[model samples]
Target: MASTAITTLSGGLVSVQASLQSRSKTLGLNLSCSKSVSAIRGLKVASNVQIDSSFLGKASNSSLWASVVSKPEEKQVFSSQLQPQASFKVAVLGAAGGIGQPLGLLIKMSPLVSALHLYDIANVKGVAADLSHCNTPSQVLDFTGPSELANCLKGADVVVIPAGVPRKPGMTRDDLFNINAGIVKTLVEAVADNCPDAFIHIISNPVNSTIPIAAELLKQKGVYNPKKLFGVTTLDVVRANTFIAQKKELKLIDVDVPVIGGHAGITILPLLSKTRPMVTFSNEEVKELTVRIQNAGTEVVEAKAGAGSATLSMAYAAARFVESSLRALDGDRDVYECSFVQSELTELPFFASRVKLGQKGIEAFVSADLEGLSEYESKALEALKPELKASIEKGVAFVHKTAATAAST
Candidate 1:
């Protein structure tokens, strides 16, 4: 009778245990096996087989305990074997203006950026909110008014300044420079204070003078990194590629033209000799392409009928440069882009040329294109140095005078 009572309780317990094992642990069992027969017989002769709450508690604890102890070590080993992907934080000053909106959109699409900060005197909140909805990983933050400028630059990996006045139909970059220079200087001063280590990509014109102004201001702050400072002259190159392709009746997508020297007319030198795919151009074609490329901004300004100049293309070019800088920050090697920088390739303190970018920024200046120049290009290049030299000196003087004035007051 005792054995019969044991059999009934033991059979119930065995069923319960098997159900729990199959449901919770996914363990397969053969109920028809010889071991099952042995377990049934062994249980029938046992004294008691009561189902207890404590037993359930113990099983739960064992499963959780096993996972907690083993998973962490496994995860650590797995993570140690993996590599980290690149990331970057980019800030665009003047981001609510005409150029800023489209530029912000393009940057919002870049996989390289982890954060994008937009700053302007007005209308930046909408830009930020709109860009934030995009499916990219970059977090968008907007700063409006001059009071938030420093906050916008805080911890930035790259600061692109496209702030200041745009040119009218007859205005030279020098004419636009007077107003834009002040804007660039003030913003760069904030940059030098807030994120001294960030790469400063100056898109404010006149780039020739404004870049020198930034260099001098950072120097005064005693935190200047030449490799981290760049004057984004990418629009010149973009115009060169487009104009040459348009004139030569070639496809624009595949043509790559290198434009060196300063950003202004006569200063911009398109190295047509080194054009990709080795296309030949008639002298008439060369002159037409060069003039068109040099005067592209003027053509846009005139086409706009004096309201604005080159905002869309300028924004695109600036975004391209920001991407290049971000890619460099992400630890990309051999990332080459043309930028005007404090260079020794020419007599001018700042020269635009191709530079390889890395973590240190501007890993090396690629002077291969500068090795030879056509007679037309060489003479144009020589003429530009004097004008570019004056522009550089003027910027240095502006920073010095501004600093001295601030000191005296």
Candidate 2:
């Protein structure tokens, strides 16, 4: 009786094991191997099996695959290494200043950036050394003072100029023109001499003036590409998005307000009707939002209690512009941002509006839905023109006047 029972038990156990193996094969599962891995190879499988901790290493990780598979389109959730692409070099002039450090950090975070060159008149080595500790792939190098400016700019695909004095409390951007203008002229002259083909982004204060000054200098050097120069007006759009989202209780990511004209007080006009995910607004809401967007920089200045200006936000905006430029250089046609550029969208020589970015820089200027604008927006746009025109003339005049004096000398 004992012998018969033993034989029957062995036969049943063999049959059950065989059934499991056959079912696994039909389902395209191979448990016959005696190896461990961190992930399954080129497959997405879900299983509820409790893998032995010791079996979760070496040859295969299929034992660690969790839950039952239900979807065919599941992507790979593996621990395989990723291949890194070749890098682009980005140089930030004035990398030691309030804006430069943060902007450098952000640019360093870009996987596309292979090298970052930081330049300043003083204290840039420390900033470069500190940033170099980040485990990112971009190599950080510092070039100090005017003598090294060319070296810093050489081989750079994008050169960002934020090298100038910032606005103080109770001071208008115009008050910054004299000093910042000279600083911009000097730095841009170097950019023209060295990396003439690099995309130039001006972030210095009085950008309305500085950008024109830079453009004139580039033209003088005989390497000017109007499509390649940009005044960083992204901050205006960023503020508009934030302010609109606030009043409408909409997501910030979904808010889209086109801020055109120059980047100063009344010149920064935010057209709210063209807002994405469309929402209606009363006349009062329109007035309130527009005013708030125009003066958002001043809002930050006041909030800082005279300690400093909007360095953090400006850095963020500048970083965004640089990334867009890099993507454009990488041949992405979908990248677009509001930038103060040489445009025929208005009577002014330079205007800020949404522009498509491409490998050659400003791909095309985007026309805002002006015809559909609210009455308030239409009137506001007309009102902003005089101030915008004056600011544009001021920028152009500064460059021409300076050049005349230099030629006469």
TM-score of every candidate = 0.77, 0.79
Candidate 1, residues 1-409: lDDT per residue as tens digits? 0111112221221122121111111111212211221122112212122222222232210001000011212222111111114557889999888888888887776555678999998889998998898755578999998899888999999888888887765677667878898999889889999999999988888888999999998998999999999998888877876777776786555566778888888788788877864788777777777888888888998898878889999887887677667656755553667889999999888999888878888889888888777777788788888988888899999888888999999
Please write out the lDDT profile of model 2 over residues 310-350, one tens digit for every residue: 89889977877787677667655567788888988777788
TM-score of 1: 0.77
Q: List the residue pairs that clash in candidate 2.
A: 36-59, 36-60, 37-60, 37-61, 46-67, 47-67
Model 2: residues with Cα > 4 Å off, grouped in runs: 1-86, 170-174
